[model samples]
Target: MRLPGPHWPSVAGRARADAGPLLLAALVVAVVTVLAAAIPPLLSATADAAVRDAVRRDGGDLQVHSRMEDDGGPSASRIRHPRLAESVDDFRARATEELGPGLRAAVHPPVATVISPTLKITDGSVLRTFQLAYLSREGGPAVTWITGGPPEPTGSETASVPYGAPPWPVQVGLSEADAAALQLRPGAEIPLADDQGNVKKVQVSGIFRPSDSADPAWRLAPALLKPVAGADGRGSTRFAGLLSRESLPDARLAFGPDELRRTAWFTPDPARLSWDVVPPVAAKVVALKAASGSSGARDGSLKWETRLDGVLRDVSAQVEAAFAQASLLLVTLLTVAALVLLLAADLLVRRRARPLAAARQRGMSLPVIGGELLLESAVTALLAAAVGLTLAAVITPGVALSGAGAPGPGAAGAVAPGAGLIGAGASGVSWEWIAPVVIVAVLAGPAFGTLTAARATRDRRVPANRSARRWMRDTARLRRAAAELGVLLAAIGAAVALHQRGTGGGVLPASAPALCALAGALMLARALPFGTRVALKRLLRSRRPLAVFGAARAAATSTRVLPLATLVTAAALTTYTLTLAAALGSDPSNALTLAPAPTLGAAVEGGPAAGPLAAGLLRLAWVVGVTLPVLGLLGLALGAAASAPERWQTLTRLRTLGLRSRETRWVAAGELLPPAMLAAVGGPLLGVLLAHLTFGSLSLHLLTGAGPAPAPPWWGIGAVAVAFVVAVAVVVPVEAAVRRRRRLSEVLRAGDG
Candidate 1:
């Protein structure tokens, strides 16, 4: 025969082809993921460090801040009540008396927000958003050290509608996008917009490049932020493009009365308390992709922050909790993705045993195969890596980095190490640690293929007729059906139980049913013995056509078919669930529903500040409200697609059974009638019982304004029902697609011809 084409080459070639996409995928995902995750922290830490350094260099021990809480002066209400104000005054005095006189403090009126037009672009300068009165217009040593520079100077009352944010908080730098969008360049003048929709023109000043976290403990990439230091010192804060004098308004509601100014951070350091009790509050003055969704710190109390052990700790705790939550979510996503990828790879290898066996018989070495695979993968990864790295660079511009003058190179190195071995967690990305991940990513398919090939060779017993392998090919139903059903039932039950038991009610049930559906669907894939043609024929017989006809056609492949199905099913479910839940579960009063999302956190340093500030409440409520929708919709969509793979097939089979398309869909759905009925009977009852048990209330029966506060509402049932239906609907279509792909003649020919 033809000298069995050198086994090694055949195997190597096959491997390279197979690995190209996966490696590229991994690299693309890893590079972007790491970079995105790195940004916010970097900015926060850098700014924090900058401020601290500035203070230290100035020989200040601590800084203090005081502001009016009510309508805010003159016509403005007092920000602090007498009792609380007295306590605050006393605290500041006590803290300062004890801490020493090295401390200093100054206060600027609470005019933080800036409105600017879209056209302003400045380079090598500051935007001067807020200029302090004492420091600006004075040709002497800053009586008030606003550091980085005083706020923006006053003049512009209008702005062009397209300019971006000015430099804020001193550390976060600027980027090309900000520059271009605002049309700012060094010494360029542009227009700005105010909240009231007013506009004005202003001079282009210097620009601040972005800064990443300087801490070696947890460094991240930087961001583009405009710094607005009245570099020329004119004492005014610019909002939008509107600028106002920094001096207490003899005109504009007499800014923060005299007493307030005396204790303001920019003023005298009365309390002398170490900012250690609270670090700097890095308000997100501009909208950032990094802080998507949870934008705005409208509620004065909710936005405060502090420092702990040289790191961040939230006085509000709400934001901190959210970050922790985000971390958990990311971990969950990573875990699920990795699990699905591994399983899919394993399944693909198993199905491809025949091809692998043929290659091995031709003579191939595993290492050679692996090398070739690695080469293909490396090339793809390198390309994607270059793209991702470049994007990271673009998003995070180089740091201007001169703080109190650029830190010593030694200091920079000591602080940021940038080296692999330094302060990177006690355990981080070690060779041994990476070994498994690498092995899994690089060798999983090949190793598994080899084993499968060996098995196939040992059992190299092809059927006399392809149809003769029916038993092996079509027994998937027997193997997977009952187990899948049981798993799904168990998952639903478990979710209910957890709710009852006061365990995490977030998404546990959703997870369980999803896993059951995926497992069952995958297992049942083996039961499809109709052959490619038979599967296609069935599709022609399917009801409610195109939305589903392709499903069967695509499913014709006997090998690695389930993996594709799994991907589709999971993705569909996740999106559906997320969207549905977000829409339905909006309970503004619940912890899950509160906007400005109050995390039931600790009170501020001086306790609740002042009379009724509706604005503050509205802001707080808005933040809290975000989570409910996100969680609800996400859960809804995910729950629907949980059983997608099987549901899709089930629908397709019905369509093939001579039923009208709509009828076929109805019949397939009929299968879930009993489950739905049961869920209806049970879900609410359980919800009530659990609500009763946990909150000692039976408000679940009531709709809005329902019963006692905090009890799960009656509308929850409707929402859950919708989520369940969505899950079923999404999966059924996939099944319909799969069923319609088969042809009766081909199936018959394969069996008898």
Candidate 2:
């Protein structure tokens, strides 16, 4: 017979053997990767939606108005007078070019006005001072002619027509409402005198009504459509008369260059506005404003005025704050996910211990074993990451440039036909998120495997040198205590820093909740055995042997820091989510919670209003709602599974002592329930406390429309705590059932072998 060489299992066979643990690892990795890939884009879209909605709702305030007065100063002479040398179209083209694409520029080229203290209309109404300004026919508001038609330019260049005397009066139009209020109708002539006492007569060529009063064009000059009350205490009002474009020259001649003003209003295309572009656009607007104010500016005579930059800055701030809050929550989830991945890796290593020990017995080096595990894990994690990233890309909706059909409140409108979408071309996989998760998943395998193998091979026999052993034991205990104390102190420091600096302080403040949770978990872990020992003593006094046996097992149970921390952190995150939802839900303007706010307040005095920012917070809450529960459940299940082998051994012994399967499960439950219950109860309390400590510092008033932060949602917290308990209770039985299905003989043989 041919000498049989050492046999190794085929890759397919090994994969089949380790399928359960590997599959679990793959699933966890995939889920985490999906979260990493999906969240950034979703959050980005949310921010984009918030920003765009605010911009659109800005309405008239969004206009960039540049006014150039014919001051006839030295700076005015230095500026190129494009209007003087070019046609109206050429001047418009030049202005449009200067403004750039996506901005519609309307040139209200130098218009002369006749400002009079009083005007006498046909009905003998002596109206207060009315200014008759020539309105540019180009880009004018759409209107329905109630009586007559729009004014036509007469082409007359008369400097001053004697009131009601020369070549017909300058043709003008008035809103029907204005005409009705002033007792003026079509064919009515109003005589007005300029500041220089030059007389001009304007005849109402038409009485019209705006087709849509909300039209942005009407916002450019509202006084033309409605009268404005004068500042005088006598209740005098100021009115505007809309003269035909052709009358501009005549008015200019009569009023002189001193009274003429050239204004150009630029309205940005809402479709072009997004969160990413806000800074650059805002910078440009600021620069424009600065240039307009400078004597050396290209168009020094023009003064550009806009609240757009201030509005954009406010929007940027709100978005950053919202992002900071969201980032904290997301970081919490990632921390929990990392802990769960570690738990899963530990489970995988435990499941592979027998095979790995056999390999070591066959003379495999620790490095070789670790390398194999690392390769296997890296391959599995990479594959999972690819699938997860693809799935995330497929599921996430593309970011639309068009504001139409946005999910935000008051955002729905007709979609522009050619609007661009940000899709696969802009893959939202934030590498910052992906790198950490992928590194953890890949490294967890080999790290846990190597350390576990090293521990397994360590000599466990007691040393004959009692004094040295005692010293070593004390040294180890002291080191652990020092480590725990250091962590605790660090946690406290972080919390204080977070309270002082708030979320804007970056990573440290964001990590505070996790640090606090870890500190609490560590303390609880240390206290658990002592607490269990007390329970054990109480149980030993009881008549029931199952209770006494369960208590003993629980007292001897090893503390797992990661699982406890994961559970506590998940609970806290869930509580925060519920609390935030409750606060936003309580707002009377439900629009802020349900979607983008129906209106965005001007960033005039106080700041941008809280509605859009609140809506962004609600979106983050929804994200937390989906993610935290899954992470918590996964952690709970993994924790339960971690103890299954030991629980099974106890169950076997209990059964040998004539206990029923149901009784064995009860014993197992008793062993697990105390810690689970502790986490369930303590986690929410910690969350509530954290909220109290951080909410005020979080600038939450921005989300609550400057209101005080709402009280914690006690009912919801209780419900979450109860649900956690129920989930843990359910998990214990499920784990027991699964363990029971494994034949007792095999379990015993495996344990012995």
Residues 1-753 of candidate 2 have per-residue lDDT tens digits of: 854332335234555787876787688778877766665566566556666666666623322223333424242222223233123334444444554432332222222222323332323344465666543424555678889887765543323333223433457788866787777888877666644555666778888887778865555566678886762226666566675555544444334344444445566555666666565566656666775544334442445566767666666666656656666766766777777788888777776777777776676677777777777778888998888777776656552222122221111111111111211112246556556667888899789877777766767776789897998899988998899899899878878867877665566676777678778777777777788888888888889888887787777663566677677777776776677667665667644245543222112222234455566567656666567767777787777777777777867866767988888877877777776777778777777777766777665655565544647778767776777778867986777667756776777777621
TM-score of each: 0.35, 0.79
Return the TM-score for candidate 2, rounded to 2 decimals. Answer: 0.79
Q: Which 10 successive residues of model 1 have the least lDDT summed?
A: 215-224
State residue 433's C-alpha deviation in candidate 2, in Å: 1.8
Check candidate 2 and list the clashing pairs.
Answer: none
State the local distance difference test value for candidate 1. 0.33
In candidate 2 the C-alpha lDDT for residue 130 amounts to 66
